[model samples]
Target: MNLRKEILVTGAAGFVGRETVKQLLAEGWKVRALVRTADTNPLAFHAGLSVQEVGDIAAVADWSSLVSGCDVVVHLAARAHKTGEGPNAARELFRRVNVDATVELAKAAAAARVKRLVFVSSAGVMGDFSARPFTEADPPQPASEYAISKWQAEQALREICRQSNMELVVLRPVLVYGPGNPGNLERLMRLVASGLPLPLASVDNRRSLLNVRHLATIIGRALELAEANGKTVLLADGNDLSTPELVRTFAKGMGIKARLFPIPPLLLLAAARLLGRSHDAERLLGSLQVDVTLKTNLFGALPREETLRGLIETGQAGR
Candidate 1:
């Protein structure tokens, strides 16, 4: 935690990136935020922070100057999962950004003699749902184009770092929800705030979720923990919530009363189909959990209440 230590963070204007940079700065690390452009980046001027405009991840001509003199690199940029694209098109794009560009950056970091490279991977690399809690020990079962790309990136990074002797930390985090990111959590927050009757009560499912700040802390830990070097860790907030539980928690976080009623799972699915929200409904009812039982966490959990508070302080419609 020396004040002189410096870090390079890609996707520095992103949801997790902003918080990660803030955390590192608060902990006495100088940060160089690699952003797409100053026009779109939201980070304010800070003495300890510097902004560098490097366009799209896949098209960046070189990463040598970007990563030079930085002790650590936290790679958080990737092609997020989206629909309405052809599978072939999606696969190629994902590979370019998630795999090709990632390995490119890692190679530059190694060549620059960066001390550590922390990769933010997706738990989707293990598939959407698991029969039990997932662990790093589980074999990757990437089913989506995006997840496959991340898996490939992790593989390439390990080999690249091994040859160069740079430390690599791969983190597979499940369902990270916070202020600016769009996901099931944001939409659910709107529904809960709308004061509509939600028929998600009595629904039983557990999803291991992480706060952006918690994941940021873990990213910092990856730098400090020698035990975490060269290891892939599955991270969660260490608290799993059922659908109804999540609704209630979000409601409480928003200071709204949850209006949940019991509806059979089949009936809910049928209603979702009628409303053309079957995909969202399925995610609401599905169970995706991970084991965050790692001994090197060093920091404790950030409660659901704190995550909700973050939403109030920093929610942005689109970023």
Candidate 2:
């Protein structure tokens, strides 16, 4: 008569996935993790955790073996932003991996009578032209190959779930940062830790960031909340900051003084272009924010003090 729910987590070896698996396990839910390989197993030492090694998500034609008997399927596997391919090649690769594989998995989950499927998407699907914080009501304007593929996948899943008995929930989270986080946030942390003077004091752009821990908790809530079904949620920490503010906050977390000086935003952009780092400058100087009220409605608002503490802890961990 035990009615504990069983959840299947795809890409359970990745950063966010690992945290999600840990949270779910701590909550007493039986977890079945589907990873690409045994070598990539993140929960290897955990007792009673069921793991399946499925090689190459893009190549998996059938997901029945891993998805059956699972009440919720959290699909987190996707071909992230991969560079150095031609336009056609990139499109095909993205379609094959993010779109096709996702659709196939959703179909299998529906057939298996899964109650819900939660898709982890990216905020990049909103594109780079947001005049303000992006909300779920905004029309999608995905620009990159990865974003395009995710948007397509969302559309496909919505239609598929609309036709099937299973429910679908899509979550588009802003740049997720936390312990062992990679990419731009990590690079920024490294720069701040090096004690180098930064010229980002004058860049007055706002950005929204989500902590991986919070994202994991949100995923769990999405699975349990029936109201979350058939909805796309835009996620952030509910605290937006300028690049200078972020640098200062990160420095505060690392216990270092931010030696930031004022530099004209236009001048910074020109210098970045001259140095062949336009994209880097754009991220630092451009505004990329998200509306997290929907998320707050589901999981409650994340306190600003708690968010800063988490960022500080993440910075300390990176050291």
Candidate 3:
């Protein structure tokens, strides 16, 4: 059924984008994968894959040519937070790429009469941590510049699609672990690999993680499922683990002993705050979860082993 449907995927060379393109092709879908000039094609040549080089997404003057024959547009390209960048600068750049460019693409897709636009958004829009599981109905409190841009993009897309014939599906996924995971998760995995004794044993924070591959599978579901249209869903692997447990799992995946010692959680948080890394500390020493408490479970829960495999796979991939 999907063989005849060509999905246009932006950022097709990114970590998640690469996996998603593969997943869609594996599911017998045709893919028009977009790659940046500097980024290598994510996958080996396949008959179902068509790679399009779009140098810089924000600078793309015309999106109509890209969306002309596509059934769905899986938007993933966005400016990520760079190290040492100021908040104001980050906000402006993120708005340009994440918000402005996303709205433009959505508008183009609508004009092209594309059936759906599946946007991969961040769960961080709810903030770095949630006291309980979050739901779609929760009012977003985007904490960082990057998150705020994503929230704004979501709103813009919602408003645009509301008046257009095209459908919209927003997926807000939590920390994803996989080959080439580029943020704190990758840092922590490397930290565990370094065998540094982490003083996080006492930090009993519950964090929900998703696999990049699982996220790709979810993207496919969002593409085909009629119920997913017009819905912004929270995504996670459903295996919430504490800081110690998480570190231990990382160690287990990497085949090492987790050298961890106990420390007062408040002391850790306070020290992190003094260092202006409170948000990063909170992710490790706080509880951030998502559930179907509101009865909006669009997908079934994956198990602890899948997360373990995701970590192990991350280890093997040298990410």
Q: Rate the local accuracy (lDDT) of all candidates.
A: 0.82, 0.86, 0.85
Per-residue error at 278 for model 3, in Å? 2.8
Model 2 regions lying over 4 Å from their true place:
1-3, 82-89
Report the Cα lDDT for candidate 2: 0.86
What does candidate 3's lDDT look like per residue over 63-113, in tens digits? 999999999999999888776554446567888899999988999999999
> In order, what is each prediction's RMSD in angstroms?
2.9, 2.0, 1.9
By summed lDDT, the worst window of 10 consecutive residues in model 3 runs over 292-301
Model 2 misses residue 41 by how many Å?
Answer: 2.2
Candidate 2 has what TM-score? 0.94
Prediction 1 global C-alpha lDDT = 0.82
Better of 1 and 3 by lDDT: 3
Output candidate 1 Cα RMSD. 2.9
Off by over 4 Å in 3: 84-89, 292-297
**Candidate 3: clashing pairs of residues:** none
Winner by lDDT: 2
How do the predictions measure up, each by TM-score? Answer: 0.90, 0.94, 0.94
